[model samples]
Target: MRNHNTLKWMIGGLVCGLVMMACSLSGLAPADTGDSEVDLQKTQLALQATQLSIQADQLAATQTAMAVPAAPAEPAAPPTSAPAEVPTADETKRVNNVNGVYFEYPAWLASDVAASIYDAPPPNADDPYFLIEVDHRVFEFQNYSLADHFLTPLINVYPLEEYQRVNPGAAAQITLLKDLISWQSLGASRPDGLPFLPIFNAAQSFFTKVEFINTDSVNGLRYLTQFQQATYPIQNGQMIYTFQGITTDGKYYISAVFPESHAILEPYDDFEYTAEFEENFLGYLMEIGEQLRAEPDESFNPGLDALDGVIESLRVE
Candidate 1:
């Protein structure tokens, strides 16, 4: 169980403070009363009234903040030491395993959602495999049903080109090829000399992070390759973090995707929602996007930090 933090959300409180200060400065009233002693006394009273009004306004702002409910704290990090705990003979859940690598999932890992298995492989196929969903899924497209159930941050036993060839008839694969072809067509709009880069740009836009980390071989099986990606939703504020690794046999792929609930993504805040602040948040997107483009570095993937011992202890037979 590991979690990669999503892009830090913009702080709306500073905007509120700046706006209130501006309003107070703009609302100064001039009292140019020139008269006798009584007039001076009247002017003093008026000055005191104005000062009290300002104080009341400031106090109201403070009180309003206290009245608003606080958002729950972000989830604590999970333990990712390596080779997550395996079920004892008595603890194994027979219903959840798919492919030869029996999944000994951590508590945080959800049961595999609807999984697809196609047995008929073309002659070049080297081994049997299974694709499973190990986290909550949200489709990128508007349709609630993916038709063939390929919502990603997914675990694919095979990469795209190979997965399609193996499962040619699967709806997900057919849709994937269609989308790939569609993205390819974007090149038509480019000036003749410009390189077509829709795939790269689209990936850059959707991904918040990409990480590589070391993995282990199990029982001389060589499924050591591993990487993780954190994706932010384009149409919504949801966050999806994905971890993908190959099994020791080099034939199976394991992925765990975590799509946070809306409450988790949209935390509670102090400021009253305003159209102006919303516009400012839109501008903040550019700043976050720049953060997203930082150079990739090699490190222990934070996504699996809590599941430290889990994968290496995988028992693939």
Candidate 2:
């Protein structure tokens, strides 16, 4: 009903405008005309046309509004990259106590492996030679057949004076071992056997990754090398990583030898020691040492870092 009234008002306004236009076209004043009914009909038709045009415009406006889409939401920020995690020491450690001395080894080394402790005989029976062994299973060697089963992997502790006292005949060897103040002063000649220990055979070789490591009570040198009596190529199950250190008080000596293998090395020690090889044996050993030194600690089985952790936890008292 309100819309009908609004439409009537609009028709009346159009009719007044048409009347004025007609008077102007006819050159007369806007007064009552003889064709008033005809003018009224023409005004109503014009009003309907104007209303249709308005309705079309409103319909077009509504369709345009529906066609357009809302603006896209802002993109989320890129995720931040996290820093590389630093390796931590294993929480599970086995406290190894032997001959009143104590240290820790990884619990993994003791699991599923034969371990024993014995008083190894020194050159002088009076000297103390405490030894502990962990069987070969502890090391995952590719060529276990080539390993020295008798040696296994062992840690030994000895009284410095008694150890030095036993080999009285070899005064030069004893003096050299005693004078081992630094690895930098190490001569071209490597020790044939374990430092100050008896040797059935000795290997002439160079050291790799040589570093001085001190435990809670001792200070010593740790290095990786193979013990070969002949010109044997560096192979799996033959490389020995050993640590030799003296107590801070200089009263006791400590040594730990662990068998390690590398995937980069030959699976077997099958190199022929020909005359040419003998001539360049030192060069061969140096090249091999360089290759081993270039590799990161993780390259070896049971990792050198893990062994260093064991040495760091030692307490001779």
Candidate 3:
């Protein structure tokens, strides 16, 4: 009888387990427990535990993704050529007692100045005895030019009226230049034989890169070209950059000439004075001018920009 009762109990437990599994698989509510409130609390706790487990897995996935490093970026290409260097004026020089003129030049160059009077006779001198105070500044590179003795860069400042009074031939040109400055009309071409004061005999030819510039208290025109009287070939160091300026009050004249060279030109000694060159020198000069006009400012030795910088920093009180 005891064994029979045990079998009956086992059979009842198996039926209960089968019924519970069937209810869970079919998405049906479990058969109600006698203690209704306790059964509801148990279901709530189980749901919360499952949600907490899912949230923990998601947080771990996010952290794992963040910890991994990203792929490195591709490097940029190298430049084809090094950039040209821009020069700076590191030294300031002054000409005292003559309109309080002062200018700055590149520190890399050697420079000096002299103040004197031009008592010599001018071809157009109104008064041969009339003296004009002149201040001359010279700048030179160590070993750049064979013609350094005459081709060194120079700056001269003097009274414009005195210069015009002495060289009366330049009076009209001075007036025209002043008018150009005042009106700011620079489109028209300037004629040849332009005077560079304190420098007689030579004339400026084939002006290129012509532009008007202003110093501290004056305005002037600047251009690049060679100066000559005869049909001379454009030699390397003979090419010059010059600035001619007048004070706003038209009292002082500032003149700057800087010798320059380019790879396109030949050295003075190397050039052949062939008869063919002389016959067509005009065309040759014009062609050279066109080439120089097209070249970048940085292409010239002691670049045009560096020379312009000195003029821009000039101050005449």
Candidate 4:
């Protein structure tokens, strides 16, 4: 019985010690678990903050990209304009024939002869008493009353040698006239019995008639009245004509009872004549007159007939 009790006591002591140790180990385990839980929570909070910071940085980069400006493109080029054209001068030119001949009478006639010829009535008379002719035909006769002084005479005579000798320079002019008339009258025959009488016969015929009426010779001035018949050759027959009278001075005066057309005799001063007139008027007259007379038309020659009157009216004043 004693042994059994002792065994029971020992067993009981061992059991009690084991129970205390088990309780202390359980309490320590609970404390350590709590400390580990606190550390894990802190780590989770730090990780969350880092993620938020990264998200904010990404948003800021996206905003910066949106704010920046882009560079501009270049503009297109403009078109060019064309240039203007210029004009040129004319290339063709006209030319005139210098050899052509033209003839006409003076602008004034009836007035000029009256002022120079008639000295009887008052200076202002209705009728001018003057007579003149051209190319062996009578032209005008009037009183010196209402007329301009533009009328003068251009004498055409055959006895130019005597006058030409006195005026030596006139020799060339006389020769030119004779040559012109002769050249124009080439196809026609002369009215005078002589074929070419050296141009003196025409003057002689005019002077002969004047000597018959005004036969009174005093000092160097001889007043004559009658005249002889003039002559010229033609294709069929001779042309006979006459002149009334002409003064010694350059003035050609006539009576009132003269024909409508007559011839005039006048003298000219050599110094006053121009070369243009001598070459153009005188030369052209001689050339054209011969051409007209060679044809010899009595009815259809008003213009040529008028030209005779024009020659009578040509003066150098």
Model 3 clashing-pair count: 0
How many clashes (backbone N, Cα, C below 3 Å) per candidate? 18, 0, 0, 36
Residue-wise C-alpha lDDT for candidate 3, range 1-317, written one tens digit per residue: 11111122122223232322222222213443331111111110111111111112222123344566767887877999999654455554444444366666565443344433333333334422112223322322333222342343556566677667654334545665676677664423323323243332233435566667875577988777664445556766557777888877778787776777778876677765566876676557667776777888878876888778778877665
**3 or 4, greater by lDDT:** 3
Please identify model 2 stretches exceeding 4 Å from their true place.
1-89, 96-98, 112-150, 169-178, 182-200, 269-276
Top candidate when judged by TM-score against the true structure: 3
Higher-ranked by TM-score: 1 or 3:
3
Q: Kindly list the per-residue Cα lDDT of model 4 for residues 207-285, writing each as its tens digit.
A: 0111112212100111111111211111110112222222233232221111121122122222243445433432332
Model 2: per-residue lDDT, tens digit, 1-317? 11111122222233433332232223212333331111111111121112221223222123344566767898987869877643344645444444456666665544322333333323345432112111111112122222432134656565666655543322233344455545433444333322322221223244577667755587777777654334546666557778877778887666666767776776554565577866665566667766777889876776888788878887765
Q: Candidates 1 and 4: which is better by TM-score? A: 1
User: Which model scores highest in lDDT?
Assistant: 3
- The candidate with the higher TM-score, 2 or 3, is 3
Least well predicted 10-residue stretch by lDDT in candidate 2: 35-44
RMSD values, in order shown = 24.1, 48.5, 46.4, 71.3
Worst 10 residues of 4 by lDDT: 40-49
Superposed on all Cα atoms, model 4 deviates from the true structure by an RMSD in Å of 71.3
TM-score for each prediction?
A: 0.31, 0.55, 0.59, 0.18
User: Which regions of candidate 4 are displaced past 4 Å?
Assistant: 1-141, 144-146, 153-158, 185-317
Model 1 agreement with the true structure over 261-310: per-residue lDDT tens digits: 22212232333545564445423333443343342321212223323334
